[model samples]
Target chain A: MTFRQSPTRWALADGRELLFFTLPGHDCEPVPDRRSLPQRCAAQSELRFDRTTGQWVIIAALRQDRTYMPPADRCPLCPGPSGLTSEIPAADYDVVAFENRFASLTEAGGSAFQLPDPADADFVSAPSHGRCEVICFSSDHTGSFAGLDFRQARLVVEAWRHRTAELSATPGIEQVFCFENRGAEIGVTLTHPHGQIYGYPYLTPRTEQMLQAARAHRTRTGTNLFADVLAHEVRDGARIVARTELFTAFVPFAARWPVEVHIYPNRFAHNLLDLDGAELDEFTRVYSDILQRLDRLYPTPLPYMAALHQYADTDAQREGYFHVEVMSTRRSATKLKYLASSESAMDAFINDVRPEAIAEMVRTA
Target chain B: MTFRQSPTRWALADGRELLFFTLPGHDCEPVPDRRSLPQRCAAQSELRFDRTTGQWVIIAALRQDRTYMPPADRCPLCPGPSGLTSEIPAADYDVVAFENRFASLTEAGGSAFQLPDPADADFVSAPSHGRCEVICFSSDHTGSFAGLDFRQARLVVEAWRHRTAELSATPGIEQVFCFENRGAEIGVTLTHPHGQIYGYPYLTPRTEQMLQAARAHRTRTGTNLFADVLAHEVRDGARIVARTELFTAFVPFAARWPVEVHIYPNRFAHNLLDLDGAELDEFTRVYSDILQRLDRLYPTPLPYMAALHQYADTDAQREGYFHVEVMSTRRSATKLKYLASSESAMDAFINDVRPEAIAEMVRTA
Candidate 1:
């Protein structure tokens, strides 16, 4: 089936943009946010360059008071009815995306700024100029994205694709990240099943590292690093969790977490925007399958973070490949593998479980 | 008064080396480990090079079944008496250091290995070659490092200094990291007041990044990066938690954690070995003071990780500086700041508390 999405845009009471995405047969009417929200204050967030580690750290003190885990009946992501006011004004919706009230970065008008020279000053900081959005998978606040139907999941993917495209085009936005943090174990403040999208003004440390590795790999082996790695995973069937015509999911050879699975398109693609409708459909199926497998691994659902690594279509990013990494801190049914001194202080990770073992278990599940 | 330590060495039943450090005039006699421990097996830990990010990951599956939170009475770290046979055989001790039973790296006597070329093969792995040790702060096991008396704290410092010197001289060892994970919130498995020292075979990612930055700083400004940073922290004074003649403790300008403080020596030192007798004594005093202050920040003891970054005394590491970073996961008395998607997956940290504010709280704590 050819999947399609229909998006209708509206504004919250505080003038934050909200977009509702629906399947072909469904329609969304723009409803006014009746809740009385204070006027949006100028973001006090600042991007400070850490001279010691050569990385950028975002300081958003206002987020300390952001909404915590509210009751299911009073979840802010839920659609608001006649009396109960929520972040969403509509009584019902399919998939919705809106600006976060307490965001680390906001859409404050600013020109694209370069990383300040370390020798220029001992301390360097600039305005955190970007955007952060929350995407709700379904109006039902209890179920996770894995529980969504195929059509609903497809709509969510469409929303992600749209946002990635739009955010990538925004001025001063260098990278766009879409990720979901599930369960309180991973510090998901909100209980509702939702994900976050961030438009970062600078390249993240991990991305930069990967890009550098890829460039070096290309120079040494004359092939794209990610593509070569994915090809190797496909060739080695031991770590393969699931393989479809359009995509493959496997446990990384050097898996950092107890339970980690990376889903990659069978063909090379820069980001979600590069995928066709059929590929997205297949991706949604495989991605959901992996999440369900992770949930079934233990008695309780796995607490995990699903991150989508995408890149722009530029010459510098020519070797980049889009993939999804789903890793869980839950090592066993009752125990969690915490990042203690070694992992937290140093960037060295010691995995308690072998990738091959986890892959076998996930494949069977 | 001048301070000195006397270290006595012994062996556990399984042949693991154990050392006891006591204050001057306090003698420790060698005791036999009466426990019928199984013969020491070769370490199963393997270091796998992650091609995507060019980082090595230690895969130690045996660590999954390592001793967890055992009962207080059965604590292996406690000094054993006549009936009980713990890791420590003596009835009491001031400070002790021993090999970890479930070490991630062991002295299997492998020659120094280089990072396998990513272009050489699809998978590259080597034996995890190094040492992992546990340092008990006190034999009482009830109080924390902050609770140790001045003489006791000084002994612990002496033990760390000795370990750093010996481990640095070990074959294939690239870095020595001394760290403590305090409180269960930070995943301290044992209730005993202790720390760990890892003699990593490879330079950690963070250390590598810092060194690269330092190299660039020296080339651009003809100055040491860490020294310049410490000078700036002292000049700014706003983020200073404490300052002494030999050291300065302050919150980094771009602190990543909610409660983060860095203690730097006034003179540039590559590692603990560079410090003299007086500097070590002063460090012990200042370090203990900061820990006490951190404990007073909240009604409950703060969950923190104290990491001591040390480098080898070599021409390539001339710009490296020794410092201690003590950061807490506790954002508030009742809240914790978990590394979510941004921080964990992308290496981008979004801190909820400002550095200056945290410094103020620590200053008055």
Candidate 2:
């Protein structure tokens, strides 16, 4: 697949790369970042290992100062006038991607995060190393991904695919995650219809669990776990929300969230990079449909997290299954599902809505 | 450990068991539940297993209608007058424990939950058979646990131990969790000084991970994971917030929450039931102190979840280690730490505070 326009790359004043993705034949004019900015953040972040569960926790103390609920006019994600500088240098662009200023992980720090000392193995510490990028879906600040036209949505998908493929090739990035946090109810600081990409230094905890489960399933049944699950959901049909030629959207039988939907491509793929032109089109269409349906369930736009799960550098592509989990905290029109004791502390989930019932709602809506 | 007064048990109007726990040698008055109540919840909840992760999720659809922040005068946790019948029958009490009216899991149902059928292995589901109970820490409507006197705290500990032991013995109860969600910020619907006991039908996801890590540690290092973690924290000293003769409170090396403290007894105990008289006393003292320190860190009482994790029925006593994880979402004086895409979706936590700094603040506070 060829894009209408190649991505134009530029650097911000703080030495962070910014890329503008435009449609074929559209021109992105060069605009320099003139605002005086620091070369790097004053605070440093690191990762620590928890011996009990063997999970890494990020400590980015500087992130406490991240912009919260900025005014729309001053939104850093939006295009600005000559005197007003934002993260993006372009006055207007189709879709833009830029490195986060207050990033939890950074590539400029070092070659890789330093491993924990062997003497104090229990108190393991490592320098936080990776990359974090913000992807603006549209130049219009008030627009959402669901509200984007087919061409705009397709462009965003292409940009995600391009980034996933490119970031996966980065020196020490083990996993790449593309996700969106929508609605202020879910603590989204910005309302500029954007998502983020985190090229993690290590495989995420949830991804590790998924790989383990898939390996176990392969050992037991000698088949792909994702393929089997998709087949089962397709055959069962009750929890299937929507389906296209190449993708199937279904609510998992044991959904942890109140409003949860997982979309799986019919054909197996390690990540977005593996998808061809047809698959990308199908994904964009089904994903947009799911988002619209979620919004229709309530009078207002649903507050949700659209998390894309894919393989890491270490894992074989066949062993990992790429899926999109769209989970909303809204339990009802006026209520939200909070991660309290059972969920936040114990990782056990007590959901108030059944998957089959939610599937029905999604189908009707 | 011998209590000053044995628990006095009575049946509520709904046929749920209610126990009154008082200081030693305190006489209890007999109060009967005269109000009409439903024998069981109007809605039935079920447990479904996700084939992908092999985790059980509870589906309690009727919980959407559960009580929100009710008025102080209509508080179900507070003691009621003769005409205004609350969940508790007594006019006033030191501490009381009773089954939840709108329980997510229940024992009133049939035997154990029915096992999933082989035919529908992918979408397996069962009745959510377990118990849910509320433990009132104080009779005052607006009281807080941190403000409770030492005697009251001791009674609450005893009540927790009592419930843990009894719930562990119940059929099909894999794990017992005692927790309290304080403040509206953490989604606590009730402001009453109370905690909850959840007799989970399956071992929680976090406990399973801990147990797996412990077993792995035993295999690889020939030692206990929890014991070694605690000893390492003690030896490190920097992260230790407070320590007594028998217990220690410290921020974990990989603390996930902005404000998190884990209290561990110097000695090993599988669950609350294993604690002797001295250990119980020490636990009460340290737990109360940590709670107070957390409250003092902020100008107002901090919104937090105090979770007591204990052994599962399937695991050997020695293989499990009981600990208390007190986590608060407060990142600063005004801003709350939100678990957006990373933490909620990928189970990767990015904390904005250093454990050592928090520990120093905790120690000084």
Candidate 3:
């Protein structure tokens, strides 16, 4: 089947942009937002440079009053009925993306300045400049991404690709991250099935570190680092969870979490933009399969963070690889692996479960 | 009054070393471990080098069955009664330190071999070679480190100094980290008021990153990074939680957690061994003060991780500085700030609270 998506853009009561991605023949004409809403506070968030670790930390004090866990009937992500208004004006929708009510970064222009000498200044901070969007996988409030059918999942993939392309082109945006935080254990404020996309003004620490290592690897072996890693994982099949023609899913050699799996396309790709229709369809299938396997690991659904790593097509980031990393804190049916002293403080992870064992379990599941 | 501590060494039933640090004129004569115990398994943990991030992750499958949250009477860190064989065999003690039975690293001699080229090998692993010890802050089973008196707190400080001196001199140890994971929220298995000390074989990722930044800072400005940071914090009094004669405790300008503070000695010091008698006493006082303030923030005590970062006294580590970082996951009285997708996956921290506000609250508390 050929995958198709038609996105129609609309506006919320508060002037936030909303986009609906519909399958072919499922055209969406969103109802006009009628509820009165107050103007959003300007993004007062500041990005402070941590001199000790050379990383930027976002201090967004205004997010303290963001939405907490509300009842299913009160979920803002759900489509609105005639009497009750929600973030979405339409009574039903396939998949939707909207600007977050409480965002860490805003579209308001904030100029990045040259950092002063460390000896002379106490801190170097810049206004957090970028965008944050909420993507609702489905209008249903109770189900999860794992429960989505092929068509719905494919739409999510298309939506992610669309957002990535658009956000990357936005001014002052250095990176775009798409991720979902599932379960209350991971502090998911809402129970609705949704994911978030962040357009960061600076490169994340993990991204910077990975790029540095990739450069070092390229210098040492004269080969692409991520490509070599994919080849190595394929050669060493001990940790392979699933190997398809287009992509390979495997538990990494140094799996920090008790359950961690990374999915990479067989061919070199920098981000979702590089994938063709068939590759994106296959990615949706593999990603959905992994989430189902994770859910089957325990009696209850697993709490996990699904991270989509995408890099821009720039010369500096030419070595970047597009992949999806899904990791869970659940170590057992009843236990959680907390990031305590060693992991949280020193960034030295000590995993109780072996990578090969977890891979076998996940593969069999 | 001048402070003094006397440490007496003993061994557990499994031949693991144990030490008791007693206050002046409070000598301890430990009873022998009479219970029959099985031989300890050698450290089977392997450190796998993560090529993507250029970091080593410890994979210790043996720790899977290690004790979880046990009942109060069966606490392993508490003193044993007539027939019960807890980890501590002694009837009572002021403060004690003992080797962990479920150690991630051991003294059973595993050699670190050179890594094969990444292009040729799928994984690079070495036997985890180091030491892990548990330090109990008090004999009372229910009280916490914050509840300790001046003399007791002094003894704990002295014990840390002695352990740092001994561990740094160990052949394979590269860094010594002393930390406390308080409250069950942060994954403290036992309810006992205790901390852990790890003699790591390699430099931690955080320490390495800090040293790298320090080197760059030194090149940019001919001054020590940490000392300059301390001076900067002192100059910016807005984030000062507490200031003493020999130490300054403040929430850093780029605070990561909702509740985070760093305690540094006024003068430069590489490790606990560098502090003199007066400086150590003042450090203990300031640390205790901060913990108390954290406890008073809400109706319930805050869950926190107190991390002590100490470096080896070598030319390669001259830029390293000794300090204590105390960070709590709690954002409000009822909520916690979880490290979800952005923080956990990308190492990008988004703090909900402002640093100056938390500092003022802690200072006033």
Candidate 4:
């Protein structure tokens, strides 16, 4: 389970670093970027703060022009010939991570973009100074991360942990968000299997709320909020999907999604980097197992989003607990949960399915 | 515009009240439901409070089996003959409001559903004691609220104001929310133009956050948050879509959707009930104008959700501001702005369109 390998890093024509992670004996040769490309700093994003809700909104107008649902042959994520260059230069690779070409957040002062405050001086507007990267789970165009071999999945975990550690140390990066949007049903532009990492300049609203809850819990009761939640779920085994020595996967007591499963490490870990070799190996196994079970829920693929939540590197550890939340909009085989006004505008969830029932189905899956 | 009328109330066979609202001099008849229907208390929802985020999630297991996309002839929201009884017992009506048969929140203690506390005793679980009602915008099933004439639109507004006043006075009701989900793309079960009013037992999460921001702004600036926001928007007229004597419609400073327009009254009205005759008439024209503009943005009908936010009856009105938020998931002619992992999981929004550009489009439409 303890496979040691270092990623071979190279730069794209746009000066975006592309890191290739492979097995010890696998090919890690650098693939030359032959096509002319703009610099990684060609575009930047504007972050506007909403006074009503007190949340920062990233406005990236150019993102509308990003690659849409391209054919498999023309997929930018797919490995291709030098003449018809795609994002990945390598014809084949185990795993890779590269700076997103159409990133919502990039290095500040890039291009001619100016970070300006709103004219009123009350509404805060700033440069979206951070990083967004694409992590290709496999070189294959069609297969998904869940369909990856055990070793390949493990490599992905390693890539995630690696990116988390590196991105957390980046300048001005406050929070590291790692997530994957799978299946075309949920607006997946590309069919190629890949995940995304967003290193945000500010703590995301959800993470801030979570930290506030944890801090309040610590102040009220001398216990970590997440630890207590995990303990409560463990005691109430009816909602548990699976458990291992290092981790437990269960439907949250008040799950927002019809098919939501939260997996937490048994030990107190603030981020994926906290997991040791044995813990990482076991964690990978448990995660892959849960994903397989989720796919079996229906005859076809179950479109889901896997989100990795971790505390900011500069933030206190007392109220931070790293966890992975995998939620699917699919309420039934023929239907998907649409987050209309109640869920979207009001931030109130009306789940048609009970947590216990979802847990039972996941368990049987 | 000064026409006055009261809704005629009647009871369905299942004990749910059905109220008919119409223009003055319109025919108001009592149409009885002859179908042997199940009682309103046959099912109820459970409210589970999530400690992590401090939000209440409603678990309505029976809603999963609620009416789906039935044929237009068999639509439950439509009025039909006595032989084939639908939800609306009336043969014809201008606008109607009735208790939702498959309500997410309903009458307290009417059902035998046990409101059990979680086994851990710390996590809160209670009977979702509130009311959910449906407001039919018109008798014609094919046309939408946007297509309704000036008189009909005004009547619909009257119905919303009536429901808000009545629901807020109900026992245990804290916040009264009025919303309309348009188009099947956003999971509208019935093609018929209608809206819903949910009398929540607690202040919704979004409303709570807005109140917090307003309170903070007041403590810091010694001014009302909403008034200041409106002033700022008015000062920067670039984002204004339309303006009437009493209402101003504009894209929010930090709009989260590609097509988002917020209409706020010029006066500091805490809720819809506070609007006077002249304000109500002006508001109706402004709202209808905005809707018409939104529909003209694309070739086909735009899928959208209209959300009405008002002050909670139980909560203080220090920071409360009544406004209507109209947002569409439609990013372009073909693309949609999906609230995937980034938005849904993290509560962070990445809007693909700029507020000013959207304003220009809406203004010109």
Candidate 3, residue B196: CA error in Å?
A: 0.2
TM-score of 1: 0.98
DockQ computed for model 4 against the true two-chain complex using alpha carbons = 0.86
TM-score of each: 0.98, 0.96, 0.97, 0.96
**i-RMS, every candidate?**
0.6, 0.9, 0.8, 0.8
> Residue A172: error of model 1 in Å?
1.0
Quote the positional error of residue B19 for candidate 4 in Å. Answer: 0.3
**Tens-digit lDDT string for candidate 3 (B259-362):** 99999998889988898888988998899999999999999999999999888768678898889999999999999999999999999999999999999999
Candidate closer to the true structure by DockQ (higher is better), 1 or 3: 1
Q: In TM-score terms, which candidate is top?
A: 1
C-alpha local distance difference test of each model: 0.89, 0.85, 0.88, 0.85
Sort order, TM-score high to low: 1, 3, 2, 4
Where model 4 places Cα greater than 4 Å from the true spot, the runs are A3-5, A40-44, A81-83, A108-120, A313-317, B3-5, B41-44, B81-83, B108-120, B312-315
Q: Candidate 1 on A215-264: residue-level lDDT in tens?
A: 99999889989888989888988999999999999999999999999999
DockQ scores of all models, one per candidate? 0.92, 0.85, 0.89, 0.86
Clashing pairs in 4: none
| Cα shift from native, residue B21, model 4 (Å) | 0.8
Candidate 3 Cα errors over 4 Å, as ranges: A1-6, A108-120, B1-6, B81-83, B108-120
lDDT of 4 by residue, A1-365 (tens): 65565678988887887888886568865568877875544344689989888888999886888888887778888775563568777767888999988888888324444335333586688878878899999988887887888889989999998888888877677788999999888998888999999988778899889889888888888899999999999998989999988899999999999899999999998888888988888888888888889999988989999999887545454488889999999999889999998998899899989899899999999
lDDT of 4 by residue, B269-340 (tens): 888888898888888888888899999999998899999988853446557878999999999998888888
DockQ of 1: 0.92
